[model samples]
Target: MELIIAAGIIGLALGAIGAVIALRTAKSGTIREADNKVKSAHAEAEQVVSEARRTAETLKKEALLEAKEEIIKNRQAAEADDKQRKIEIHNLENRVMQREESLDRRNDALDKREHQLSSQQGNLDRRSRELEDLYQRQTAELERISDLTREDAHKELLDTVRSEVTHEAAAIIRESEQQVRAESQKTAQEIISLAIQRCASDHTAEITVTSVHIPSDDLKGRIIGREGRNIRTFEQVSGVNLVIDDTPETVVLSSFDPVRRETARVALENLIADGRIHPARIEEMYQKAASLVEQRVQEAGEQAAFDCGIHELHPELVKTLGALRYRTSFGQNVLRHSIEVAELCAIMAEELKVDARLAKRAGLLHDLGKAIDHEIEGPHAVIGADLARRHGERPVIVHAIEAHHGDIEPNTVLDVLVQAADAISASRPGARRESAENYIKRLEKLEKIANGHEGVERTYAMQAGREVHVMVQPDKISDAASTVLAHDIARQIEEEMEYPGQVRVVVIRESRATDIAK
Candidate 1:
């Protein structure tokens, strides 16, 4: 038993020893493996460091090459810039030198011109002194040749010139007068003829008494009424005179106021036609007649304005203008005459290149005073001007109205036109009538006035005393004096006599050269 226990202990001891040996060998093998791994890691670290150094060297080389190339480019650019500045400076220097040369040449030319001018000036001054000496010698020689001194000769020459100039001036004056007269006469005749030809108007003589025809003489009694009550009422209401005359069915209504006369005529006619004759009936009929006449006046005025191409006449002016319808100047109807004058003025104005419308307006209103001349106390022209001025007429128009009749001097072309038109209208053939006695007296007076002038051989009135021909003795009245004689005669006639239109005085100086060839 002891021996078996000893063997088991010995085996256990051997197994313990083997286990320790095996653990020591395993630890040594692990240490060898770790050492090999350490060597491999060290080798890899060395390769990475070497590669990093090579990459840094390559980058440094590339950067240095780029920097050197940039510096070379900058140096070349600076050289090019320096070369361009040098070329510009050279061009500027050449231009400056050329300009200096040009300035020097101009200065030399100016100096030369100045020297030439100075030389010419000295020559001119010497020549001027020589001319002065020559002129003085010539004046002395002339004065010595003539016995008279310079002052006396000059006075004699001036007197001779004055005498000759007087004759020449007279001739010139005569010639100018002839030329102006001829031209003005021709132009006036043409315009007057044209205006007359273009306008055709009818004028009838109007009397202050308007004759109203009744059915019978029996009705005249009724018109006169009981104790002339009807006639009195008519005259009072219509402001017209009722004349009951034995004129065979005609009752005369007389009034200087054409409107009143017209109203009375209408009323009388109505009373006769209606067979109603009484105070009350007369008043009513007069009222009706007045209204009718007023309407007619308005219508006539409107028509006249329309004919004249005027539309803006004041209402009162239009009415006043219409009243001219019943008025008369000479034997011509005043309204028709006014219308004719307006047309004539317009035509003449158009020919003369004046304001035709304004002329027409003035012409139409020129005779406006004639319509109320009985009521007003002045020249019709002045009254008409006042009327026009009151009605907001322009100052120029008012002036023209006032000057149409020569009551005032004409101040404008319009005034002259109205005057011409009025004269033309009044003096046209058949425009007016004069009593035979008065006509003969006027013609005789015209002839007498011409005969009364000195050197008058005979005188003849022609064209209804509108023209006078005076025969002058050739020995008494010279050729130039004949013109003066004619003017004098015309002036005398104008002052001594009143005539329509215009009068032309012609002086005939005939020199008889009688020779007998026997």
Candidate 2:
């Protein structure tokens, strides 16, 4: 057992020894692998550090190049800005120098002009003094030669001029009268004769009072109505006066307006015929009568226009013209008179070679104012002229209408023709009439007007007061003065009198010289 034990110990010892050797060998090999790995790691770390250094050097070089290029760009930009500023400053200096040169030239020109003006002023002052002295010397010389002061010579010259002008004016008046009479008298007579012959219209006598025949006297009370209601309503509505009198079945309707009278007449006649007279019935009848009259007025206007050969009249104008059917002037129907005047105007216009249509139109409408003269306050001629103008008549036609009555001066040939036609129509025999008393009064007035003038010995009113003959003493009135006297008397009559048509004044002067030697 001891021997086995010793052998086991020894084997153990050897195994231990081997195990130790193996352990030492494995440790040394691990040490060598560690050393190698350490060496490789150090090498790799050095290579990465070297590459990082190279990359940092390259970035540092690029940064230095960029900084240098930025400095060059800045310097070039500064140099270019400085060059542009210098160029602008040089141009400004050139402009200033040019302005100073132009100002110097203007100043020199102004100084030259001032010197010339001063020279001209001095010359004008010298000339003015010379002229004043010359004028004084001439005035003194003229006073010495005349042997009279300036005031006395002036008065004497004025007196001579006044006397000479008076005589010259009188001579001109006489000569113009002779020339006008010789030129116009025969032509005027012929035209007037032809117009009168061509137109032969009948005259109608219309009065303000229109008589309505009632069937019996009982109608008067019915027409008057209860408590005068019917008559009052009639007057208020128709604008007419209802006059009831004991004239045997005759009730008179009176109004200054012919239209009102005519309307009232028709209404009363209708009321009497219908036999229903009350305030209501009267009013109804009045309205119907008014409408009927209005229609008649329209028709009459149309007919008058047709007769006058004027178809272009406005509707309102036609209606107004028809109103003349009920109107009258000095006992003559105004419509008939107007138609006659139109015909006369047309005939005279044809003879004078003027506008016959225009003449006829003016004459037809010349008395248009008489249609409404009672409502309006003006001369009929002016009123008619305004009416014609408002209705689109030409200015010439309006002027002719206005001037036909001598309301304004007759400036045109048409105006004269209208005047002559109006006169001829009014003054023809039986064309217009007045009471005997008024006729005698007018004749006496005509003679009295002529006798009131100077240098008149006697007066005679001829042609039913159409003309006046005045005898003047030859010793008191000269030939030229007679013509002036005739004109003055005619003008005075026109201003003072309201006679129809025109008046003729003849101032007759006879000069006689007696010889007693045989």
Off by over 4 Å in 2: 1-178, 406-410, 435-441, 471-487, 506-518
Candidate 2 accuracy as TM-score: 0.62
The list of candidate 1 runs beyond 4 A from truth reads 1-174, 473-475, 478-480, 509-518
TM per candidate = 0.64, 0.62
lDDT of 1 by residue, 431-502 (tens): 999889999999999998889888899999988888888889988777766776787788888898887878
lDDT of 2 by residue, 49-78 (tens): 565556667777898999999999999999
Clashes in candidate 1: how many?
Answer: 0
For model 2, name the residue pairs that clash: none
Model 1 lowest lDDT segment of ten: 1-10
The number of the candidate with the highest TM-score is: 1
**Residue 278 miss distance in model 2 (angstroms):** 2.2
